[model samples]
Target: MSATEEAMNRRIVLARRPEGEPGVEDFRLEAGPVPEPGPGEMLCRTLYLSVDPYMRGRMNAGPSYAPSVGLGDVMVGGSVSRVLASRLEGYVPGDLVAGFNGWQDYALSDGTRIRRVDPELAPPPAFLGALGMTGLTAYVGLFDIADPQPGETVAVAAAAGAVGSMVVQLATLRGCRVVAIAGSPAKCGYLREVLGADVALDYHDPNFPETLEAACPQGIDVYFENVGGAVFEAVLPLLNIGARVPVCGQIAHYNDSGNPLPGPDSLPRLMMWVLGRRLRMQGFIVGDHLDRLPDFVREMGGWLREGRIRHYEDIVDGLENAPAAFIDMLRGGNLGKRLIRVVPEDAAGA
Candidate 1:
């Protein structure tokens, strides 16, 4: 289709800056003409759009690792899409690729920042989950940063979610004993039964900290932190000397406005522990470790192919449901990697 003919595309835009927690009114759905691919560009139809906790930081008005979405602009996101038309030499129609396509039915890209996918090796949605950023986050954080050794105890919060789930499986594959902390009993069961965690505890329990302490009697050697706030507070005392902490996300504090939680500032105590114990605590964005992506893809893909690493996806249908799905994800409603099926590319036969 010609660029002018494709101008009737639909998209979700940022309606307003969210305060505390985001509501449905914060997004505006609009219909516009399909944008034509310019010279050296390609037209893409989104198949799967990712909904992640990190996007919460982009909705607020502040300086972040990435730019915040401006009012009336299409909300930014990563998506797996099929190239509808290509002006770029390396790309062609029917090629599935992953890129920053935002939240929409279709997007135009200049062939930069897009990676082609091999569907025969894995399904398309795997490009958004296991073989994509989520897998990279877990692999890089655990192997490169945390560096858990064989027979060591590793603890992960939000252990049944995307990054956390991958960490549990990978750590287990590495011969490390894994203890997982999930939000509910069901999620904990998935961690133990499906992902092979050595032990799983529900964070909702009144004595969750005590349970976690009991689970890690040797102290946590590697802590893959996905949920911060209370979980971090609970894990602080349980960290062994020379332990490694890979700070990935802080979903627990994502919806908090500016109000501090009821507690004394624990920075001093944390610093003391860091100094006294010679612990390594580091925060990282997955993009910073892009050089390791090739290694991660090769290893993770092999594991998945061998039935060693299993992944789950909680997919919602349509572009319009993105906002609600995102809100629900922040509330721990999603069991695994939360995604929205923007188009039924994978359901071609159905």
Candidate 2:
């Protein structure tokens, strides 16, 4: 290998799967010689790697919407990358792209499913956030599934998060009164001040249930379920007749080892309410709505450009920091989209 090629690669792998919440010991960082581009492949230097709650599910040894990361495998993640070398037909060395490039400083792809990102349109990190999966999740879950109409009350749990923030902005743009539930007073303040939520409440408050009840006097017409344990329990009582719930994620239960909590089982009561209220509750993985990607891109892209939609990101430095960043995300340590800067691929441009 050439000396220049030996200068640039680092990777983080799954050292072991955690029984519950993942820790730094569950990951390993390693350095190696930079890879060369092969026929039909392009070598990309990662710019930003995303850390998300869904990654927690991938750490467990069980069936989920996606496959779990095997022990000793490089951690899986989506990233924004710049092509450092290219053997692929359509890609050039400077082209920026977004794809599932795992947790690494460098990755090689054949360019089949990669999307070329226009740096002129948005910054590289935006590809890992607002214009990417997070935005798409909020767009589809709110419009396509929940279908909130004007004057309806929309309540979203984790409302200050990457996806939930967009849910608030989009619902407000549609003329619905948005009630946001966040982890702390600070996050609740951001939701109300920056995102224009009509009402923002802290889930940590002792009277959170009563606060939510007061906020949604007309009842919750649309409940965007992000955190699924106690938050869902609180939302259950506020759901209006024929309310629509688009179950996007379950961050609250992501760290749980699938063991039932000791308590009066709430399923029987929940089932009765579901029947009596005639509520529509459905779970969705983003892949299930692939057909709407174009629609999301067009409409949400416009919302972003028109200043009707806003996004936030909490960036952690270095690939080695991803494990801690991910763990903190589960505990609501992050305020928006969590991302790690893997390398300085777009430094000169940004």
Which residue pairs of candidate 2 clash? none
**Tens-place lDDT digits, model 2, residues 1-350:** 54336566788889988877788999999888778888999988888999888888888887777999998888998899888788999998788999989899888999865887877666778777788888888888999889999999999999988899889998999999999999998999999898899999998899999888888888999999988888898899889999999998888777777563434567778888999999999888887776787787778777767877777779999888888888888889988888998766645132
Candidate 1 regions with alpha-carbon error over 4 angstroms: 1-7, 259-264, 346-350
The lDDT values for all models are 0.88, 0.85
Instruction: Report the poorest 10 consecutive residues by lDDT, candidate 2.
Output: 341-350
TM-score of each: 0.96, 0.95
Best-performing candidate as measured by lDDT: 1
What is the total number of backbone clashes in candidate 1? 5
